[model samples]
Target: MSWYNTSARQLPWRDPGTDPWAILVCEVMSQQTPIARVLPAWEEWMARWPDPTALAEASPAHVIIAWGTLGYPRRALRLQECAGVVVEKWDGTLPRSREDLLSLPGIGPYTADAIIAFAYRERTTVLDVNVRRVLARIYGEAAPPTSLKAWEVERASHLVPDDGEAASQWNAAIMELGALICTARNPRCEQCPIAPHCAWLKLGKPEAATPRKVQAFEGTHRQARGKVMRVLRTAHAPIGVEELRERSGLPEVRFEPALTTLLADGLAAATPGGIQLPIE
Candidate 1:
């Protein structure tokens, strides 16, 4: 906790007394997107939505536009859907229990547990990438595996502090440690707060056999979809289906899936004249 107090980034989501809904948004936005990109988007997103009731009343198109190049736009749709439930069923107060949170759309075990620990300050484990890396280095004595094993989860669960306040502090502390000093690439082991206890460091710090690859963006269907979204977001009127195809410039093979995704995810609506963002 001391190390995290000194070393942790002053991220907005981690600010004192942040709302549970905001924490949920942070967890979802940061799932696949990098934190650097998520920060500004989060600020804009909070300013726009502010609460679940506000987001539930928002148009799907507006939600997608607010997402803006975070990638995996479907998550934006899911977040809106989740907000609807929070407002309609829970009366805009996100449920405090883990089971209730997990039942919400886009709330998986990790996200549910995170909300419990970070937002509610409940005794719960947050097994995010950062926490996993720290645990792997300390106990497993190796680089964190790409896929979490059952044993790893079991071992980690036991480490969660039984007390609510202590658990929250410990959870945040480990995550901050892994994200900074115990980083995946170029870990600063010398300055690590728990380096003396890190088994991987004692074993000479071997690297993972395979390095993670960055996904290609150019000419991919995802890029085509993004282009399509940008056009729809900025358009004053609906665009013809034919015009959308030309504007997206995607091959028939790529175009079909991207268009289907936009429609299926409710990012676009087909009117008699053309296609545009969903109407409020």
Candidate 2:
């Protein structure tokens, strides 16, 4: 906690006065995306839609365009859906309980726990990739499993402080520790606050028995989809199929499948004019 107080990055959402809606936005934007990239986008997004009411009223096209290069554009649509639900069902106030948060679109267990711990300052186990890795090293003497296990959740739950305030701070501290000092690729153990107690470090930092699988991005359908979405986001109006395909720089085979998936995902829509971002 002391380390976090002195060393943690000064993020806007960490402000004590930040509302749960803004914290929810931060949590959504941070998933699978680096904070550096999320920072500017988040600032602009908040400036445009400061609350659930504002976001709920925004067009899907506007929301997706505002999402920019966050990679998973689907999350932008889901966030807007979540905002609509918040406005209509919850009367524009974010729900406090984990179960209630889970009911919101785009919110999973991790995001729910994050909102509970970070937004409401509740005593809940908040685990992200970084926190999971740090805990695996310190307690399990190895990297986290390819998938999270029941035992990991149980252990993490058992470790949270009983008091809500302390637990929230602990969650933030551990997550920051993992991001800064206990990173997955090259941990700076010498400077880690918990290095002395880390089982992996004490055991000489043994390598995983099997190498973790890395997901390829280049030359994949995802890359093709990104190209198509970029074209849609930049277009002044609905673009013809031929123009979209040519502008995306993807071959017909790749472009067709990417467009199909984007349409199915509601990230894009087909209209009389042509293909464009979803208006609804």
Candidate 3:
């Protein structure tokens, strides 16, 4: 089937008229977050900020709070920073070029390409985990994409329709195919639109030798850091070291490491009383 013949889910940002700022917001929010969770947040954000200028003018603390419950609150700061750059540098516009978007704070290759293709309706290869999985399955590759290979982009670029409107639809359709059917876990292959052409399906889906790496969460320094940040994110004033120690439930030694990590990562800042979100 042609890429367009495969029906896909309709996403707000996939619409041709979606503003670049809104598309950028979706990209950041969707990082490490499921689409189900990001939709409501995106709606609220668009309703509140509407554009780069509005987000740039808002306090970082307000942005963090508004970002509500999206883990990795530091992204909020980087997003605010990105908005400021977009408004100040781009004259209140998001740059359409991939290189220019990549130059923005917190925007990496995937995000840059995503904004260009989805928001600006540019014909560019947009690769994310889902797209990678779909590509791998279609090619019957054993390994998932380790790095952004030149061929991968070229292949995706070829699939994009030459016409602007169809190209946008193809972009969204491919992504929706990846998310709903060609999933990493518990994929619903029977319902996939492109199952007939799937090389993995033809060859019998083979398991990869190495399982995907999973990050250790519990009992790690990240957990301790999260505990510390959770306390500070909720606190109205800067907290002291002693209070952080008590709240994070980490040893005195671990507390130092956690605070240091947070500070180094721009997730937290040192204060006279204790520590706080960089807002202070």
Candidate 4:
């Protein structure tokens, strides 16, 4: 915890007494997006809707527009849904239990655990990509951590302090270390607080035989979806089908699938004219 206080990155979500809604928003936004990109968005979002009731009352279109190029526009829809559920079912309170959090849209195991630990100060394991990487390098006997391994969660839970307050700081510290120092590429081991104890460093940092596969973005359904969303964000009213087709510059075959995904994911709405982000 002391290591983190000295080295912790000053993030808006890390502010004292941060609401669970803000924590949840940060977790969702940070998925697949870098922290640097998510910070300003988190700040702006909290400024606009600091609690579940506020976001629940707002339109999904406004949320999508405010999300602004975070990639994965569906997260905006899921976040809105999550807020609405919190308002309706939980009485505008963010649930501290992991099961309750998991029931919310856009929250998987990692996010649910994070909200419990960081927002509610519960003694729980937070196993995000950064946490996984740090633990893999430090403790993995044979291979780097792949996906969310069951053992990793057990190990992380073991590391958590018995004291709730200290444990919360410990959780945040390890995650912060992973984010700032123990990066995936070009980790600054010399400056790392835990480097001396890292098992990967103890052994040579060997390149894995099978490299991780990168998600292809260009010329894919996701790209087409982004195009459609951009058009909606810029359009003042419901855009006609012809105009959408023209603006997206995507083939009819690709456009249909992308549009279906968008609507299915709650990112867009169909109108008599065509489709648009639900007007707030």
TM-score, cand. 1: 0.93
lDDT of 3 at 246: 93
CA lDDT of each prediction against the hidden true structure: 0.87, 0.93, 0.81, 0.84
Could you tell which candidate, 3 or 4, scores higher by lDDT? 4
Would you list the clashing residue pairs of candidate 4? none
Point out where model 2 deviates above 4 Å: none
Kindly list the per-residue Cα lDDT of model 1 for residues 95-204, writing each as its tens digit. 99988998999889899999999999999878988889899889745566777788878898899889998999999999888877888888999899898988888988
* lDDT, model 4: 0.84
Per-residue CA lDDT of model 3 for 1-280, tens digit only, reads: 2644546556787665778889889999999999889999999989999998999998776787777777777788899899899889999899988889889999998898788777887677778878878888888875576677888887767777787656766776777788877788778889887888889888888888887788888888767877887777788988888887898788888788888888887777786776777763
Q: Name the runs in model 3 displaced over 4 angstroms.
A: 1-7
Best by lDDT: 2
Q: Clash pairs of candidate 1?
A: none
Residue 112 accuracy (lDDT) in model 3? 87
Worst 10 residues of 4 by lDDT: 140-149
Winner by lDDT between candidate 4 and candidate 2: 2
Put the candidates in lDDT order, highest first.
2, 1, 4, 3
Q: TM-score of predicted model 3?
A: 0.91
Highest TM-score, which number? 2
